[model samples]
Target: MLNHEVYHKFAPNQQYSYALSYRRQNVYDEKAPYHNEGVEQEFRLYGRYAYTFKLSERWKWKNTLRQEFRKFLLQTFTRQKRIFSLEPD
Candidate 1:
């Protein structure tokens, strides 16, 4: 899995410019076809800010804030075990 996004503005401050995001996930085996082998490599970074105060430009109301964090897949998947045992001899 791979995703990338980019947005930049700093010459005139287009609503307080700032945007950059990236994603990556890798795992080997299991038929191996979804970008196999890297054993999960995730790196997330996000920072966004927007402000608009016009109240008369055709109805204005804009406010945005974002913050993200994640450094490589740490693995988290647990909840599947419904009893399966029968051996008494």
Candidate 2:
């Protein structure tokens, strides 16, 4: 698997930020049941927003919201499935 991301800070105080990322994965198995002789591929695109604040002089709190778009493919690159997800942390 491989991933790359770019991030931007929206506030000079660094309280707000956003990022965009891309990921790719390759799977291999000899005894699996799906996708081109047990080999599969996946690709993903992600976007995230984050906010941070001070909880105390020595502590901080952060929250993040993320969205993902993903696709699965056979080893030959034929599309198999598409998925979308939203997550908060």
Candidate 3:
């Protein structure tokens, strides 16, 4: 699935603001031996932050930071093979 996200700041003097996000499931292959695009899943999230500081009346400095996370769940088609990802990074 795809999602559209937005954020807003209400305070006038709010030089610092932040937002968070979350999601689940990624790349769940549920196809047969014929390789059918029956069902698949994936998830991703990202966050960003910024801070404003004034060095002079006309000059201001802005610093920003960002972070993100991604997850995927790939299920096996056969009963013998186990289902799971090695690292969820």
TM values, all candidates: 0.25, 0.63, 0.34
Whole-model lDDT, model 3: 0.48
Each model's Cα RMSD: 16.5, 4.5, 8.1
Supply the global lDDT for candidate 2.
0.61
**Model 3 bad stretches (over 4 Å):** 1-5, 10-43, 71-89
Best by TM-score: 2
How high is the lDDT of residue 53 in model 3?
78
Q: Tens-digit lDDT track for model 2 on 1-89?
A: 66677778877435333344444455545575634444456666777777778789899887877776666677677876543344332
Question: What's model 2's lDDT at 79?
Answer: 71
Question: Per-residue lDDT tens digits of candidate 3, residues 6-81?
Answer: 5544454233334333333333346655444333343446555666677889998877765555444433333212
Q: What is the lDDT of residue 45 in candidate 3?
A: 62
lDDT (10s digit) by residue, model 1, range 1-89: 45454656554434444334444445566674644544344445556676655678488676776665545442342222322212211
lDDT of 3 at 51: 64
TM-score, cand. 2: 0.63
- Point out the higher-scoring one by lDDT: 1 or 2: 2
